[model samples]
Target: MNLKQFWQNFGEAAVYYPQLAQKMGGVSAAILYQILGRWLNQSSTVQCSLKEITDATGLSEAEQKLAREELKARSVLEFKLMRSQPEIYSYTLNFEQLEQLILNDSAVEKTSTVKRDPYFPPRRQPIAVSVTPHYQFSGPWRSQQQLEAFQDALLSYAKQQGYSNPGGWVFKIIDGISKGIKSPFWDEFIAEKPLGSSQKIQQEWEIEPGVPYPAFESERIQYYTHKGEPLESAVAKARSELRNPVKAKDLWEGFLRKCDRIANDALKAKKAGVETPYLPPSFSEQSTVTKASVMEKLSQLQGDSSLLEAENPPEKTLSEEEETSSDIPSLESLNNLYQSPITQNWVEEQIAKHPEWGYTIREGKVIDQYPF
Candidate 1:
């Protein structure tokens, strides 16, 4: 019994597809593949939602779309949209295609020649939306009308109960109080806030963050936040400090120094540079020289002018070790290629420039950008 060589595929609980990962040249496609494998275990055809797939794979909505395309192009899987409302879809794996892919590559591939992946992001925890314990529907919702009626009932409950800010969670409160009863003893009862609720992206803001704060302003807030200040408070304080020239100057210097330090580790990436998994603070990938870092460096700077670079330091480029692979395009690489102001013509230009990307994929394929 070759224990290490054997795979316990029957009871595989976590996400991975090593051979498929190698073939896909990245993890997103491999993750989607494993998720599909799990669904197929139940039946020949399995139907599920995009959210289910996204939750399992931990890939963003954008990355999930790309993963499906990669699997399709590789001829390893088929995905079809089953329904629209609430988004139901099904995937079928082509086991024969997968077998051939592994067999052919395994037959001739030398251990020395096969490249190793530099970094693999850990699986992000699924943010499952679970109903709180002791919570159930207010009434039997056998028909769509009953569900609609619940809304009117909720408004009446709110008015009768004098609820001020419960417009968002009326259903949550109603469900908990009703406990699946055909009729509750009272029309309205106080509902405790659901446990494990996600924090609002922005709390009731007392200061202007301009929706997305300016880069330097954001860094200033993050620095304070890291030090345990509330986000809204941080914004107010950051704005006030930035208004002072002396504080702002000190912060900019500190920002430059901080960025220089981070860039060194990121640019010399182990495999494709940006040593850290996911995004990094490199000029080639993303600039750490944003307004926020600058503000943080200057506003709260101590005696540290000697160690930092000049007013504007040279941008760090990716090293030989971090250069992007020149095979079938990875989604991340394609995304980097298709930067902001992504129009159809701009996408086409990038495609023409990188002909290899077009070999397996159509020009401008799956490069979804806003407004185009």
Candidate 2:
């Protein structure tokens, strides 16, 4: 049904004349004002019936009573009971008081801005194309336990998305660590089996009746009210989110696990006297890199004289600043090979790309808070 077709004209300023509905209390009072305002045709007073108000604004009779009490307390309106008519009431509005309220609020806003130097109003976040924002960790600056948690969470989330072995999904993340994790076959894998479609809505619309779906509620309001989406479409979107609440954190952990696995492998190969301890970053067909090539080249593996033909790396003196094979590879040594200055710049780039981590990186220098 087109609810807008039956819309009535009213004072727009009433909703936020003094402050927002949330700041003032609830939207009940503001909604009450709109209903009464529509009936006042060049008159301050209007006879309003509770039944009529309830029919116009979906507000119950008890809600209307509380709204009237709030409006009277704010001095924006005064209502009197009509004799012999329990459902009817006469409302008298104060236009001067409402105008004064708006003027005072505007003055406060201007003064606050002037007092606060270097003030920047909050920027509206860019709309996400996906229902949920995905988080990825290409570097292993975190603990092994944390990495395992990320892997488990990622696999669980991918399962929810109906993907079998979501390692390809994790591997496609824009970093050189794709070959490190469960993504040796990533190039041909996800291309063949893409992520599955979202789950269907419940045939019975009773997704735990009486309990409000919090994540779905936020999405529903944005879609239905702000984006002007149809009620049916909004309901479907909300239900989908309610079922699949999180995706980013899962991906974040999974990729981190892969990086850690790669780092551990490199450390083991280094200790085993392997000539080429590290895998080449690229895994494309043109790239002359294979897991078998590196595994065969391992000097610790005996009986392969052909693989032994590979030349050893030149011996280099270790500086105090340089880490040995015994030492766990720092963020700089593994994924990021640059020094502090360049590494710090990369941190800023990551923050910009993943605005979802904005809260965690706010307190200190972005790199400081990061495990790196």
Candidate 3:
């Protein structure tokens, strides 16, 4: 068939395997056309390895694999060993050509010349490629259980949003944590930081933050849309719409879970005479004091009344000396006073956008509120 006719048939096949059409590049498609057309005209098998085809067509290995699968899936080509030499044997379609009428000519038919194995047939194994975008984790996490809790929290959030693959979603979560990738979760995590403050920055600036979490791809099957939409789109949608704001509100809850796990590990570690005690901020929050009160007490410990006033204080009461003294500065302090409240409000606004956690931990137990 001519290129036009081939494409027409290929387009018809795309309803079932849309990725074949979606992933094909110009060179790879051309190579498919050339190889199939030549085989039809010459009536013989073609000897070409993946490297040779890539070199001849100037296509990359990835593109060539895509094209090869596209043709194979359509039953246009077959890969098998002929006399112990790997070769691509072209199968001619009965509708595309006329068979010779003479009895002797029947033997010359390409279909008759081809070999088949009934027991062990040539089957294509799908290659696992990284199609999802990278996710990275930030902040401090000392134990594996704490890390796992965070991952579980993300998976729960994604599933609640109707995602098809919760494992894949969890892979993205772990991937993000290991690589320090800037995700919506991290965006929300840093939102509460004090203004003009630099948050905990990772050391290696050159590293690709989106690197897939180690063992993540191997541990689970990646998600793909039935329509064959790119995996990246699903991840993008998950980070922005499905998981973000909800994940932000779930931060303290996730942190608490992580803390419980950390506390268990810490108890074990302490029994082993390990001095380090790992506790999430939520665990600290559980004591009779809140973060605000802790900050107040810490300020008192430091003997800095100004620090206490900055964190918590009664309504403003300016002394005549502080009001009139140019040495105290006014405009800069006024700007800071206004800016801090606005930043705090914005952080609270992001938290307020989160969807309520509705997943069941088990039967009759659902996480429906934050900071539990």
The number of the candidate with the highest lDDT is 1
Question: What order do you get sorting by TM-score, best first?
Answer: 2, 1, 3
Local distance difference test scores for all models: 0.59, 0.55, 0.46
- Estimate the TM-score of every prediction: 0.25, 0.26, 0.17
lDDT of 3 by residue, 1-372 (tens): 699887787343311223323323334654654554454555545555655555455667687667666655544445543566454333333222222222234566665767879898867768988865673354455666666666666676677768899889778756766676655553443454322134333222112332322222211112323346566764454333312335433543554465568778999989999897765332343344466665455434544435334333355458843563333212223233324543334223322443331212223222334335
Query: What local lDDT score does residue 185 receive in model 2, on the 0 to 100 scale?
Result: 27
Runs of candidate 1 with Cα error greater than 4 angstroms are 1-13, 84-86, 110-372
Clashing pairs in 3: 135-175, 135-176, 136-176, 136-177, 136-180, 136-181, 137-176, 137-177, 137-180
Q: RMSD to the native, candidate 1?
A: 35.6
